[model samples]
Target: MELGVIDLVGGGGAMVAVNDSTRTLRRTRSIQLDHVWRALETGAWVTAGFRSATPWLSSITGESPSASSVTLRLAERIQQMPQVKATFADGVLAESALRQLTDLWSFDIAGEFARDERMLLGWALKFASGDLTMLLATWLLHNDPDAADKTAQEQFESRELHLSSLLDSMGRLDALLDPEGFNLVRAAIRHLS
Candidate 1:
């Protein structure tokens, strides 16, 4: 499936437009991503509801999603590759890794900060390519204590709501990865750049 950027969206099927060609993939409103997780593991949902955007996807004639919602959802999913990789890699993950990875890569993909763009891209590509060491070290880049602590710190005191959402998703994902597994540190990581 074409795991690229999404342009237009609306409420029959979703369309994924690549640099050269454009293709449409059909989906259903009930095609919840969680169901995809039900049948597979991480990186397995490569083209379930995403086929509409990626022409190479198999025809999953299960459900139908409006063009707008599917397009938006596909785009959102593609956007989370970096953080998802972070969440799946072995070891306990903190919310800061999720925030920093998302923030850095989102800006990179959007081309908002060319000066710092390459730096984020490098980290994302490394993470996606299974660079476990770099993914683990990402937290170090965010946390600071003395001259800035490189260690992960708890954020339960200040960002209860933020942590709530972050943990909710990560917690669900954690369970998906390991049904009996769960990470409850309950905090977001802060990166000092």
Candidate 2:
């Protein structure tokens, strides 16, 4: 099977080219939340090629073609956090809450908090109010007043969320397109530079 290519630009953006049996879809966009959503949609459709049971079409569809299992795995990973686990186990974690919590996991601070489960749980609760980023900024400001400015923190949060969304989309796409493992395409476009 011919795999797609995802080229990363010098400016930290990505351009993806995916080919399905019918047509080829190429997208050039910034690494943002909306762009990731579009990638997910496109990947879902391209991956749908596997849904066809016809043997001839199966060759180009790649192996291990199913996104449902991968989605479940993602949900399970999110549930590993103590707070998320409890909320999910108790049925208190709705789709929106789950999404927010998962999104929060994309931040670098999440790894730091992971070492202390109690703190992570507290932050998870704070995530519900949409103040997690603000609180993190406040902490950073307290630690390094000169460096952790509000604007920088905001940009950091935005980048974190964008990356999180991108990875989430890529996971979905990989589940459908390359089930064995993630096959990230790398390319260099001089024009983008």
55-74, model 1: which lDDT tens digit per residue?
21223432222223232333
TM-score of each: 0.23, 0.30
RMSD of each: 17.9, 19.0
Q: How accurate locally, in lDDT, is each candidate?
A: 0.33, 0.40
State the lDDT at 154 in candidate 2.
47
Candidate 1 residue spans exceeding 4 A from truth: 1-100, 103-116, 129-154, 158-193
Q: Which candidate leads the pack in lDDT?
A: 2
| Candidate 1 Cα deviation (angstroms), residue 148 | 7.4
Error of 2 at 114 (Å): 1.5
lDDT of 2 by residue, 108-179 (tens): 454544655466455644474457656554554544455435444544443211111344465322322221
**How many clashes does each candidate structure show, in the order listed?**
18, 0
Candidate 1 has an lDDT of 0.33
